[model samples]
Target: MANTTVPEVFATETPEATVEIDAGAGKHVEPMLWGLAPYQWVSISMLVLLLFAFFGAKVHKTIAGGLDGKIAAIKQQLDEAKQLRAEAEALRKEYADKIAGAEKDAEAMLENAQHEADAILEKAEADSKAMVERRKRMAEDKIAAAEREAVEDVRNRAALAATSASRKLIGEKHDAEADKALADKVIAGI
Candidate 1:
C-alpha cells in the first residue's frame, strides 16, 4: 500500500499573489522600515546629532542676546549715576554760594547798623555840647543883668543920701524946679 498519506514534506515557503498596477498609479513610493536595525540606528544617531547641533546654536545665540542686553542695561545705569552725581555736585556748589552770599549780607547789615549807631552817638554828643553851651550863655547873660540891677540900686541909694545931706546943709525946702535945674547943670558940665 502506497503510504496512504503520500509522503508529506516540510516546507517554509510563502505563496505570492500578483497585484495589478494601472498606468495612472499616482506615484511610486519608498518603503518604510517597520523595525530598527544596526544600520538604521547609525542613521538615527547622525540625525539626532544634527538636530542637537542646530538647537544648541540657537540657544547660544539667545544667551548671547540676553548677555548683551544685560550689559547695555548696566552701562545705562552707570551713566545715570554719573549724571546724578554731577547734578548733586552742582547743587552743592550752589548751596555753598548761597550760604556765602547770606553771610555777606549779614555782615553788610551789621556794618550798616554799626555806622548808624556811630552817627547817632555823634549826634547825641553834639547835641549835649550845644545844650551845655546854650545854658552857659544864658547863665552869663542872667548874671550880667542881675549885676547891672544891683549897681543901679546902689547908685540910687547913694544919690538919696547925698540929697538929704544937701538938704540938711542948706536948711531949705528942696523944690522940684531947683533940683531939676541943678541936676541938668551938673550933667552938662561933666
Candidate 2:
C-alpha cells in the first residue's frame, strides 16, 4: 500500500490537499434486503400494496361503482331538468293561447260596443228629427186655428152693425101715413 497526495480545487478562494490510498478501488457494495436494493424494495412494496388494494379490498370496484352512481345521478338530474323544461314550455304555450283568446274577445267586445253606440246615435238623431217635425206641425195647426177664430169674430161684429143701421133707417124713413099706406097695400095684394 502506498499513500499519495493530490491537490483539489474548490469553488471558493481556497485550495485543499487530499491524501489518496488504494483501498478496494473499483469494487462497490450496497446494503440490500432479500437480495434487493433499497429503491427496488420500495418499488416492490408499492406494487404489493396496489395488488392488495385491488384484490383484497376491492377498492377499484368501489371507486368505479361510486363514479357510476354519480353518473347515474347526473343522468337522472338531466332527465328531470328536461321534463321541467317541457312542462314550462307547455305552460307558456297555454298562457300564450289564453292571452290571444283574451285579446280576440276584447276586440269583439269593443267592436260590439262601437256598433251599439252607432245605433244609439242614429236612433237619437232620428228621434230628434221626428220631434222637431211634430213641433213644427203643431205650431202651424195653432196658427190656422187662431186665424179662423179671428175671421169669425170679425164677421159677427159686422153683422151686428148692419142690423142696427137697418133698424134705424126703417124707424127714420117710415112715418105714420107711410106705415098705413104700406099696410093697406100688403092687405089688397093678399
Candidate 3:
C-alpha cells in the first residue's frame, strides 16, 4: 500500500524550526509549548464581544426589572403592615368596648346585689319587729289571765273562810242548794 500522510490533505502548512549548534546554549532543551494562536484569541474575543452585545441589553433589562419587582414587594409589605395596623386598632377598640361593657355589667350586678341585700335585710327586720310585737301581746294577755286567776283565788278563799266560820258558830249544816245559791250571789256581787 502507498504511504498515507495528513500533510497531503492540507491546503497550506507553515512549519517553524529552530536549530542550536552552540554548546553554551541552555543545558536543558525546552519543549515547544502549545497554546492558542493570536488569531484564535482575537476571534474568541470577537465572539465574546458579539455575544455580550447581543444579550447585554436583555440582561440589563432583566436586572432593572428584578430591582423593580423587589421594590414592589417591599411596597406590598408596607401596605400589608398598614392594613395590619388598622386591623389591630380596630381590635383594640373592640376590646376596649367589651371591657367597658363588662365593667358596666359588673357594676350593675353589684348594684342589683346591693338592692337585693337591702330588701332582704328590710324584710328580716320587719319580720323580727312583727315577731316582737306578737310576743309582747301574748305576754300581756298571759299576765292579765294570771291576774284574773289570782283575784278569783282570793275571792274563793275569802268566801270559803266566811262559810267555815259561820258553819262553826251556827252549828248548822247548809244544804247543797242553799250553799250553791249563796255562793252564786256572793260571786256575782264580788
TM-score of each: 0.45, 0.51, 0.57
lDDT of 1 by residue, 94-139 (tens): 9999999999999999999999999999999999999999999999
- Candidate 2, superposed: residue stretches over 4 Å from native: 1-52, 55-57, 145-190
For model 2, where is the 10-residue window of minimal lDDT?
Answer: 11-20
Candidate 3, residue 144: the lDDT equals 94
Clashing pairs in 1: none
The TM-score, computed over Cα atoms with residue i paired to residue i, of candidate 2 is 0.51
Q: Which ranges in model 3 have alpha carbons more than 4 Å from their true place?
A: 1-35, 152-190
lDDT of 1 at 60: 91
Candidate 3 C-alpha lDDT tens digits along 1-190: 9878667433122333222235686543222224455466778899999999889988989999999999999999999999999999999999999999999999999999999999999999999999999999999999999999999999999989998888886556667787789899999999
Which residue pairs does candidate 3 place in steric collision?
none
Candidate 2 local accuracy as lDDT?
0.83
- For model 1, the superposed segments whose C-alpha errors exceed 4 Å read 1-49, 131-190
